[model samples]
Target: MNYRHVYHAGNFADVVKHVALVAILLHLKKKDAGFAVLDSHAGRGVYDLTGEEAARTGEARAGVARLMDLRDEMPPALATYLQLVKEGGPARYPGSPLLAARLLRTQDRLTAIEKHPEEFAALKDALAPYANAAVENGDGYARAVKLLPPPSRRGLVVFDPPFESPDEFETLAQAIRDAVRKFANGIFLIWYPIKSQAAADAFTGEVLAGGVQKALTVDTQISAPEGNLDRAGLLVINPPYGFDVEMYAAAEILAPLLRADIAVKWRAGTP
Candidate 1:
């Protein structure tokens, strides 16, 4: 569907994805050990909500705007994610790169990949403040494998694809599988839209059948997929011990406030 992330900048899908991304990265940072972050399909890194595309639909109004509007009453986890967004005002949205760079330690490095030349330039500019970041303009699906096990062998890979095609799902699953085989200790966070229950189910099946240890699938939907963007999800491989609990609490706290019929579900296969 030629889904450009620009139009959907701070929408519910972005909310679900970025919140989970921040949560995972934060958990990884809790330890004294340094870790690297590999962001594949990382969009321009930061988005201006006041821009033409964002102003056109004002999607953030119902997405991140709603979250910020309810910030004071949210649980700690939800609060943490919203805190970052609120920092930049409703006019700017922090994409994955900005999120990671904000929380990463000096020793922690970040590798961001964006294929679109224009967006890649924006991504580079957005990440310029961080001395530890490296921006690559290319197809991340290929780079993820090529850059497996980052330098530290301790890190998380963030996959936030535009999902222009369904085949991208299989490719994402395979890349995670390949990465895990190469760096068994690293974590992988993959974001996807919940267009159909069947699609979500199929992706979950792929993760389980791949024999990935400590895998979790957390999904949130505001409505049944019927003519509108209805849901968002994150597939977490090797998540930290208590991450699912935090994610559950965040979802519960966010559902009612952000409700378009938002529902949260999660499952872990014998990790």
Candidate 2:
């Protein structure tokens, strides 16, 4: 089955991806110098929870709904993500583009790319309100390499492909390496699914061999690898100053709610 992101828009995978996305975006906000955000495979930038796709899966009910229910009591990182969701109301979700756009100051810029025609249109529409945000309809993998080392020389790049094709692994890995080669100093965040321990681990090895100086991989195993909802992970290169600490606190709160055998680990050459 093709994995339409709308079906899993706010699910556990998204929870991990979005929360980490928010954390890194927050770090970019700390500095006075203007920064940029390039979202590869940006999805639609917004999802209608009440639509046929989302309603059919009802995944958001479990993901975003659960997050919303616990918003008032959530840890700091989760609470921040929830704050953005709350702005969209119960019927919608703010994808990474919107989330990063909200955090951007006048000096900051955002360029989001999506290949799916329908989703790309929605991405443009979703970001139409932001004067500094640009939404593109094209191949994210290709765009990532072209948009790297932006003029600002400081920014975060998010690679969140649909992973519809198996070859996406090699493509994503090389695309990341290409982007890093041009801007090793910029922060890179790659979101991926946890299909199996070995597959995911091997991918991490590929990322390591890609030449990023400081990198961290965070994987959460929610269930046995028997179903689509099994697991998810995020790879960060040149991570924010305090991502690990904040992610640990966020994971502890989410683990009990997810009710999965979850663990968080860090593997890198630096603090």
Candidate 3:
């Protein structure tokens, strides 16, 4: 409950997550049928990159700030993400909800869940203009399961928990099991901080044991080994066709700018 994303908005991890998100959303658009999106752990729909929190951390300076200058050099997916960030204005960056809202068609729907009171209020206000989207102040994990098998029958579910609780990883794994049981075909994306290679391996092992098919893990390490979070990863279950190739290409482009090592791999059960 104490975790707030304002300080780390648009950091290297955000770049990786949002870039992959943009790619997946674009893939969803290829079909004529409208699709829904559930943004579990959606923060305030937008963040101020120049705000006090952002300034104090200075994370974006080494993250989004570096990419803003290389617009033309980015891959199509990453370029699209950067353009969305730029459209948010000079000092602001769009969170997952806002980014998803921008890509949603009239027939599509988006539900953004935020449990934090103040953040929920802000999220409601930020998403007010989108009639196709709704902002709910509730537990994202619980809401995710309750809202599965959406009316559209085709959708994406994003889990971006804060990892504030010691058991968050286990909790997330359980949530995945519950959600997959209800909507087996739904695309699931889970993001986690990579503090160490061993920890990441253990988590990935647990997820692989969950029996999800076509799971791909994408990660980037921006700094040399230290006792801090210089790396982050995303686990995508049932990713879109060709998404793995596109994500690897995007990570290659982002690695040098952020001084990160990129690792792209297919976990067990992937096919």
Which 10-residue window of candidate 1 scores lowest in summed lDDT?
Answer: 262-271
- Structural similarity to truth (TM-score) of each candidate: 0.91, 0.94, 0.95
Give the alpha-carbon lDDT of every model.
0.78, 0.82, 0.87
Model 3 RMSD in Å is 1.6
Tens digits of lDDT, candidate 3, 27-52: 89889899999999999989998989
User: Which one wins on lDDT?
Assistant: 3
lDDT of 2 by residue, 108-129 (tens): 9999998888888888999999
TM value for model 2: 0.94
| Residue 86 displacement (Å), model 3 | 0.7
Where model 1 places Cα greater than 4 Å from the true spot, the runs are 71-76, 224-226, 260-266
What does the lDDT read for residue 61 in candidate 2? 69
lDDT, candidate 1, 7-75, per-residue tens: 788877778777778778878778888898999888887887878888777666667877655735654
Residue 131, candidate 1: C-alpha displacement in angstroms? 0.6
lDDT of 2 at 84: 90
Minimal lDDT window, size 10, model 2 = 221-230
